[model samples]
Target chain A: MFSQRKFYTPYTSPTDPCPPIEVKSYETPPQLYLGFQPPCLPQYASAKEALHRGTLWPALYSPYESPYKRGDTGE
Target chain B: MWYYEKKLQYPVRVRECNPRLAKFLIEQYGGADGELAAALRYLNQRYSIPDKVIGLLTDIGTEEFAHLEMIATMVYKLTKDATPEQMKEAGLGAHYVNHDNALFYENASGTPWTASYIQAKGDPIADIYEDIAAEEKARATYQWIINMSDDPELNDGLKYLREREVVHSQRFREAAEILKEERGKKVFF
Candidate 1:
């Protein structure tokens, strides 16, 4: 038997009273019908930096240099 | 819209000449659940997907092209030095009879990869879920290939491809939840 077993019990949990439920106002869910919230973009030093991060445009901006930088040599 | 990358995404330096493995590897390049199917599926789906999710599709779809190259290169290297007798002995003669040692777009069973392997449902929810499923299938296929192979050179590449599938699935799940929530708030006057 571990001596630490008795020390593991938190005395507050069982003796704690049921917390009062705070009443909240009827909150309508956020909707595009009301307005739109765009995704928060990261701050970049420059356009090049953003492009390098591939955040501005992923398809057009490649993060790394092209693999086929050298001239095509047939096998 | 596409550029040829002469190099593979992952280096595949298979030292052994196993045409049989090459035949099986072809599935990853052009099979039903292959990288080509994934690339084509996501790229085509991008057109119909919501603007917010287009980037996700574009990024993943484009990356699939790199995987396609990696798998194709593996196949090429595996069979590059295989003799006709070796090819026949390895059961690659059927493929050889059709296209010889040159790479032809086909699955392990020699079925040509077709556009029908994927579809753009025009529904974001369905398409994104389908994308996740496709990734899972591709991951399983890579595991199958890894199981059959003892080559360390090949396993490294396969493991990388398999890990990518897990990441892609996670991204798709995020995209799906966003789409679902956005749809939930829709109302008619």
Candidate 2:
């Protein structure tokens, strides 16, 4: 003797609501500290002229000389 | 006026994105001591400055406009595909909750725009000093934002911004020196 059994599969709709999503929170790390040197003064004869004309100022000008003076010597 | 044209001092290329970092950079656009304020302050102040200092201020002021564009672009790219959920996750609470997908013009903390950020007193000496302080403040803010972001792409942009602040500060200092020299030569009663 043999026995037969019936089974049905339920249909899932294509437009069914999405299942709740579980998202893992991401932590933003603290920003790192870094030091930046100031911008370098452009070294050019014309820039030196501009310095003399008060149009440019070299970052490392000697305190003794007016920015306009032109000499390698600090004085 | 005879017209002359000049090209961009630096190339403006499309940069990579990290949406979270972009939101903070937006402060430079409309925030206190931001590029918009810097540009307006210099340009407006130039009017009352002596002829000697006016050109320098004008040139620098114009450059600030370019910087404003750069910041805005960085923000746009960062936020391009940002979903509301991601925005909220990124701690851009105000942007997500209030503006939806719209990018309203606001400061870093999402405050509305104001003219109080700019000051253009007629005195040239006063103006130049103000310019120096403004540049330093902007540099500091850039540093603070750069600290907050971990994205290298964002960091690159921030570094460039910070460098520009340094350069502008030096230029303004030079301008101040020029003003002081002129005042020194003036005959006083």
Candidate 3:
């Protein structure tokens, strides 16, 4: 299975003014994993849940977690 | 032809007054890859696109309008009771001077939206590619907006919009392949 969130390390300078950002991360959309949507793909159980999730199909759903909250940022 | 919806596609709840946050949100509300641009671009291109993908464009284009309304509601609630000082501090001084808390079709930087931000290339492949890129860019903008905002309630709506971008992008990609498979195929007029 492909990971939705990805991380990488950035180069740091000896005399850098700000604290070095050791790790940086970003999200990959679900479409990157699936070549093309197929018919009869599994869907959310209820329309209300699908509406809240913003997609009817769970395979296509990709949740975004803020890097700031994830501690992936220098802040 | 469209029917009016009295409610927003997603609920927009702004629990606190934050003019500064509202200022940042104006980017999506009127920015190049914002909901309005997305809506206009897809709807305008639908007429010239292939019949197979026309309904996709129509449905997504219509949904973009609903997203636009949600952004408008969030901005409204965020700045409804903001003081002049708060507006100034929020970096909306020029906006207040001109629109006085009214929503303008301009970006966060105060540059008004222009048709140059979008394209209606008659080529179906080119247009569909543009639509896919637009979805990705909108998704990125939503992420940045979510980063800037700290209000959980507001983030809920932003997250929904961002997820919708992913869904739309997937649909557009599927449409592109659907168009691709039509290569060398003919339709009787």
Candidate 4:
């Protein structure tokens, strides 16, 4: 007969807890870089406000004016 | 949901008709690392891409179709009205024997286009990285094509195509960063 798969059982309290691995990242991209900004949801009144609130994800924090916006209206 | 652009993203006005060069350039049209492959890969991947980045995928993928059309125009212009003797001398007689000056689906070296040239992994990170790589490869191909000829008309279009690849790579990079944040994955950019 083929071996039947057994369901995973809950861990007993006798085992040591798994240690967390900390990754330090200096290569993390910023909200704005080299005259370009990654796409961001315009939730914050300003990117300064988002940074003040400690929002770190780059895509969620755009700071540049989009060149694609229509200029005929002169915004 | 799409509107046709009456003009090419860049004009493929090849001043000289060179079947030999056309044979090489055709790879960018239908080869493994060609515009058609780029268009199909991104378009197919968009359905599985996160909703926020779907707009990026669709826009870039649609632009790839324009590049595809440009390549086709170049190939067609190069081969149209080419004499049978010219075709044979240019080592395209084998292609002419089969296609008779028509645009058949084949790479620069006459390999038939195949769907296996691309991937639709349905993973946003993986697919976007693949997209980025595709743009780089396409850009390199355009550069190699440019190096082979001094035709101003062809060079202008090829340079524009190469520049678009750089812009597309940047967009894909932005899209990947967005998807990473959306999915809460932490990795260096």
- DockQ comparisons of all candidates to the true complex: 0.02, 0.02, 0.79, 0.02
Pitting candidate 1 against candidate 2, the one with the higher TM-score is: 1
Chain B, candidate 4: TM-score:
0.93
Count of clashing residue pairs in every prediction: 0, 0, 0, 1
Question: Against the true structure, whose DockQ is highest?
Answer: 3
Displacement of residue A30 (Cα, Å) in model 4 is 16
What is candidate 4's CAPRI-style docking category based on DockQ? incorrect
Per-residue lDDT over A13-43 for candidate 1, one digit per residue giving the tens place of the 0 to 100 score: 5445775222211111112111222366345
Each prediction's whole-model lDDT (CA): 0.72, 0.65, 0.90, 0.71
Give lDDT for model 1: 0.72
Indicate whether candidate 3 or candidate 4 has the larger DockQ.
Answer: 3
Measured by lDDT, the strongest candidate is 3
Screening candidate 4 with a backbone cut-off below 3 angstroms (N, C-alpha, C), the clashing residue pairs are B27-B108
Tens-digit per-residue lDDT, B73-126, candidate 4: 988898898999999888888998998998877897888999999998877888
Show the colliding residue pairs in model 1. none
Q: How accurate is candidate 3 locally (lDDT)?
A: 0.90
DockQ of 4: 0.02
Let me know the TM-score candidate 1 reaches against the reference structure. 0.69
**Residue B112 lDDT (model 1):** 91
- Model 3 quality (TM-score): 0.95
lDDT of 3 by residue, B1-189 (tens): 999989999999997999899888988889899999999999999999989999999999999999999999999999989988899999999999998999988888989998999999899999999999999999999999998888999999999999999989988999999999956588889
lDDT of 2 by residue, B58-98 (tens): 88888888788778777777877888777877778678788
True contacts kept of each: 0.00, 0.00, 0.79, 0.00
Weakest 10 consecutive residues of candidate 4 chain B by summed lDDT: B178-187
Score candidate 3 by DockQ.
0.79
For candidate 4, the C-alpha RMSD (Å) to the true structure equals 18.4
Better of 1 and 2 by lDDT: 1
